[model samples]
Target: MAPAITLAAEAPKLSSANTGFMLICSALVLLMTPGLAFFYGGMVRVKSTLNMLMMSFISMGIVTILWVLYGFSLAFGEHNSLIGWNSDWFGLSHIGLTELWPGYSIPVFVFMVFQMMFAIITPALISGALADRVKFSAWSLFIALWVTIVYVPVAHWVWGADGWAFKLGVIDFAGGTAVHINAGAAALGVILVIGKRVGFKKDPMRPHSLPWVMLGAGLLWFGWFGFNAGSWLGNDDGVGALMFVNTQVATAAAMLAWLAYEKIRHGAFTTLGAASGAVAGLVAITPSGGAVSPLGAIAVGAIAGVACAAAVGLKFRFGYDDSLDVVGVHMVGGIIGSLLIGFFATGKGQSAATGVFYGDHTFTQLWKQCAGVGAVLAYSLVVSAVLAFLLDKTIGMRVSEDEEISGIDQAEHAETAYDFSGAGGGVVGSVSASALATAAQTKKVDA
Candidate 1:
């Protein structure tokens, strides 16, 4: 009897510990979208507050559906250099429950859901740049199209197994390039096409709620631990632990650096500056945390905090109205983090890649990092501009001047974030009482 052909190797076993860990990580990443909503919502004028929150919240709905439908296939299935596809990934219908994700101990489903959270937030990041004036329906449509055309393809390029960047040895530990840079570039593109907010530099556009910004930043800081560490796929190695440590170290350093810069440059360490600095630090450490030492992480964060603080002022000089400094913070921070990897990568960490400062004598890794960053920035900027231009010409991307002045929440959502009708017991309350009396008189006359 032809000795039954023995299986070549034992099937990969599932680790319940890793599975449970990934599930929690997925939840944490999902929390970031709502965190982002509060962050951006508080930064816009009160008139557009609810619209701002909806812009981020709607991404959770739109991207989740797309990820399940065909997004996972395009981003992570069988691949070409630019994109991926597999018939089985449609609607995630064909994935088996116990199938492990390649070398990881967790199930493929866990990996897919974890990635879905990332996809949801990338476009949401762009919403901050287009705040106050975009039509909600148009913005929703943009999320659908942008995720398909920009985000999915970029995710494949940076993270897919056969992606050109991945094969070319770009080390994006999390998503400095794929998520932040892509979203930031797209934000720049769309804003250029849509024109500026009505007031732009002329208006006194300031954050309405510092507390909301702080709360959102706090949530983002907490959730980012999962975002940075979980990219390692498992805690079997010490890399995830290192990433966790680096995340905290980098964020603290960045926050302090930003406050120092603010005190020196503007003579005040503002709460807005602290919140913005912490976010800048989070962005900078995202891609490099796994490869850098704790000390290196502090350097990355400090640099990003100062650089992003400076960059936020450029929107005025350059004539772009980036309502929330999305380009300044996310784009600049992503670039700083991704490039610093070429400088600070230790051969001892996640991979064997060493940077210029860590024994590598050549600029090869730095060049590769540049290529990845440049390609993503250029593609996202151009394509997103085209998408916005087309939408503006066809269905219209902006609200009317009348609607914009009246407030996007009332124009688009028919809801208000806060109620002032009873606040002072003044004109609004008198108007309400008069309206109620008029209604009662009309009812009596009809009877």
Candidate 2:
């Protein structure tokens, strides 16, 4: 190991090349949040499109402030089992920090910001399950609080050096249990507490725009590069290059598997099917990709894609109203990734773990993986239930019936997405000045 240095050691000595790459990596993670916004926004009803977008954008603001405030301290600060001791902001004012990853010279702050993107998006993804009903202000407050209380602690446990799980030798290269499973279970908990939206099952509510859905899918796919690759914490070295390749292959394989399954079962290739499958691949690879072999990644991704696609239908059977399939995709994909690693991981140069393929201590590793999954589900559900109850009783959750029916865009924001029909009926080009004046007045009045 390189020489250990004190906190007083001059600012971390990173190469210019490493710093440039890290900056790009940080941008990559930031991109995922907006990518998430598009992904969820397309899944909601037309009436609540803007509100759905707001739900995600709000996370960028709320989580950023919270992460800086106390969330970072609770997560990464040095201290005990339950929480961190609020060490200096990972050397905030130092201009750089010693690289934490193996053989990297990048600053610690670079890694922190990349992870921050994930912290923001995980909760934002849950908003899909609770879409179109919860009060906007209440949501803003809930996610902020949830991240600090639930997310930070768990992140500390899995990722922080002093985290219990990390100390226990549980390997989560990325956040399988911490991010995906935690968010998915928490989504279910909050949705149950908030209850179903009006006519959730009775009404055949369809997505307002499929084009928007496809666009969001593209963005998510693009941003995921930073997500899986940036986990390397530096340049395209052995680990980073390997993760980058695995991510691409697994996603392609899962996409193919999903389509093949659908064609055999449903007789048609749906765009939504392809999008869902791609995300499932991404999630399944998040934790295990760097550890597992290429063949292993393909196996995990394809299985997760097919399994998640099937799981999405369960809401209709079980009647939970997980409006946007958060449970099906994130929860199921996370379980697949976390467990598959036990069967697929192998001892490499510095990585001493081995899986069932190696036929050594397979059961023990698998058991450990299962336990991690169980812990996240139990903790997130219980904590989320309490939080949701508080919000429901205090500020209330669902909107008024009048507001609900009119749609959040107009009901809450006083705006409609499209306004082509005027007294100059179906007029594409021109409208009377008086009508234009009236429309402007109506918009101002509503605002």
Most accurate candidate by lDDT: 1
RMSD of each: 7.2, 6.9
Residues 1-447 of candidate 2: C-alpha lDDT, one tens digit per residue: 111234645434566777677778778777877877787788788789888888889999988877766676678776875577555664354333555432356665665677778888889888888888888888888997789789998888877767777666566667888889999999989988988888988988777776777787778778787787777675534777777877887888888888888899899998888888898888888888888878888998899889988888888898887988899999888888888878888766115677787675637667777777888888998899899999899998778878888887776667766666674354654556668889999999999
Tens digits of per-residue lDDT, candidate 1, 1-447, equal 000123438545789999999999999999999999999988988999999999999999999999999998999976698999988989999999998787667888999999999999999999999988999999999999999999999999989888889889898999999999999999999999999988878889889998999999999999999899988888887999999999999999999999999899999999999999999999999999999999999999999999999999999899998999999999999999999999999877888898999887888888999999999999999999999999999999999999998899999999888876666557788888999999999999999
lDDT for 161 (candidate 2): 69
TM-score of each: 0.93, 0.89
Show model 1 residue runs off by greater than 4 Å: 1-11, 422-447
Q: Name the best candidate (by TM-score).
A: 1
lDDT for model 2 comes to 0.79
lDDT of 1: 0.92
lDDT per prediction?
Answer: 0.92, 0.79
